[model samples]
Target: MRRAARARIDLNALRHNLSVARAAAPGSRVMAVIKADAYGHGMREAARALAGLSDAFAVSCVQEAAVLREAGITQPLVVLQGFKDDAELVEVVRLDAQTVLHEPGQLACLESSHLETPPAVWLKLDTGMHRLGFAPVEAAALVQRLRTGDLVAGHPGLMTHLACADEPARPESETQLRAFDEAVAGLPGEQSIANSAAVLRMPAAHRDWVRPGIMLYGASPLIGVSAESMGLRPVMTVGAPVVAVKPLRPGDAVGYGGTYVCERPRTLAIVAIGYGDGYPRHAPSGTPVLVRGHRCPLMGRVSMDMLGVDVTDVPDVRVGDMATLWGEGLPVDEIAEVAGTISYELLCSVGGRLQAEYVES
Candidate 1:
């Protein structure tokens, strides 16, 4: 079935972005974060595309990792949230997956498990995120317990999440780095702290493994640094076709609520996309949409299955013309800004109804 709205997934662009991450942190291994279904790009597809390139894969939970395993992915999978209970721990062991020991209860659960072979573990230090991990002061003692308990396979690697690596001017990242370094001062294991933002900006945080999430999908993690400027290419392009075109007289209202009134005689193109297809309904007028290779301004409110675009200046725009929501010539970030959101939300929010096409080259 041909869907009116579609998203094109570019695997070549995905590889290019992975290369960019490798170049940014030459000494660190890349753990591609594929959580949230690879940021809604489709988990198994993304894992397959990145299988050979990524040193390892990181997901939010065991179920997501199981998807990759079922897809025949052999790369090591890291469960960021760790196991919720001993049953999940058994599954982690069965899948040969690694896990992060972020909280005291997780360690307690592991201590009680009697698996013949335990999965490798990463000890998360709280640093300052406060969302996960043990306090820096308590991390060393926990690490000691894990090492002596024989509950974890191999020495547990040290990991921390940075609270403000995207904000270069802030000292929070540096402070966290200092705390992480001190906590794991004499401990023996790999250290990791850099996420996508830190992988590109903070070299010091790229210790052992660099977890690149949004950057792997070619979206900028920092507010000021664009993906293109960082040598990254977008992997997804969202588009829809124009369903109707009409002439509007001055003083005529368009769409529901009559919020937008044509100031003068103009040509309007009705695009077959809207909030129902994951286009942000909150996107205000003047959002840019490309029609027939020409930039057109979106007018009025976005409806459930359509949107209004001012095609008065676009030459010969007609029904069946393709309108690019974002990708290629249009950056998703720009649309996200006009929508009062971020590109991550825009990409992840793409509805299931929209068809997806994967391009290898």
Candidate 2:
């Protein structure tokens, strides 16, 4: 018998979330961000599912873009981080992938590395994120530089990352938007400003293009909002089978560090998943896991390959019964909250130990 965790990927749910983004910003073009292996939902499958719906696709690097090209994804692909060196720049051109020029060195590389045909490029403006992009004040000069450069395409698209779009009440997004607008004022080419949060909450940031990342995977982008309320369905439903069961008395301790002491007569269902299988090791006791469609509280500490859950309330609980870690009936956000992390970390951290099951429905 196997003791590995499993992730059920629903392609329909992915498409539905993409539709939500599109519906939120009907005027702007959709650049579906499929980086980090489509945020651990399988990049190839996600690309195939939303091929016709998205105007473009985005990945962190050129290698990821090549994967989509090889999988017969014909839509325009944008390399979000862009090429780091000439070799990657060559591959970007060969794969016909668009790239972002965020710094002077990258522009210098582009100018030095001449190709037969220039790929489309996006100029990142560092309005406030300060991670990538050039100084917002230099937006006009940067645009002029790209337009006048030998290796640039027809026109470089203008884009910037939002610093606090998730916190809609914060003024940072407004500040960033204002800076981006002032920097690229009357500048040539398309402007992209909104991310997933901006797409759903901050409508004013929606410009020429909108990039949606986590929302496409059916995870909530807002802090307190649920994905279901935003018309999104969970795409990656993860679970593991119960391998062993044990009865504990009121004073009985469980798992490592004896973090949980039984308060009453309890039946514990030991699950076949833990930190080793990408289940958050920090998820403490009381974190909910769905067993037989009933919510069971996780007990004690999580080990490398196993975790214990209080299944006393579950009637007819037995070994080999499935216990859902997240997704399906259990929202990943709930688990993330208890673990003190984000849904993105959980999704991307799914290790090879767990088997991935992709389904159409």
lDDT of 2: 0.91
Name model 1 segments beyond 4 Å from true. none
lDDT of candidate 2 over 27-99, digit per residue (tens): 9999999999999989998999999899999899988999999999999999999999999999999899999
**What lDDT tens digits, residue by residue, belong to model 1 across residues 23-66?**
99999999999999888788889998989999999999999888
Error of 1 at 143 (Å): 0.7
Residue 55 local lDDT, model 1: 97
* TM-score for all models, in order of appearance: 0.98, 0.98
Clash-forming residue pairs, model 2: none
Error of 2 at 191 (Å): 0.9
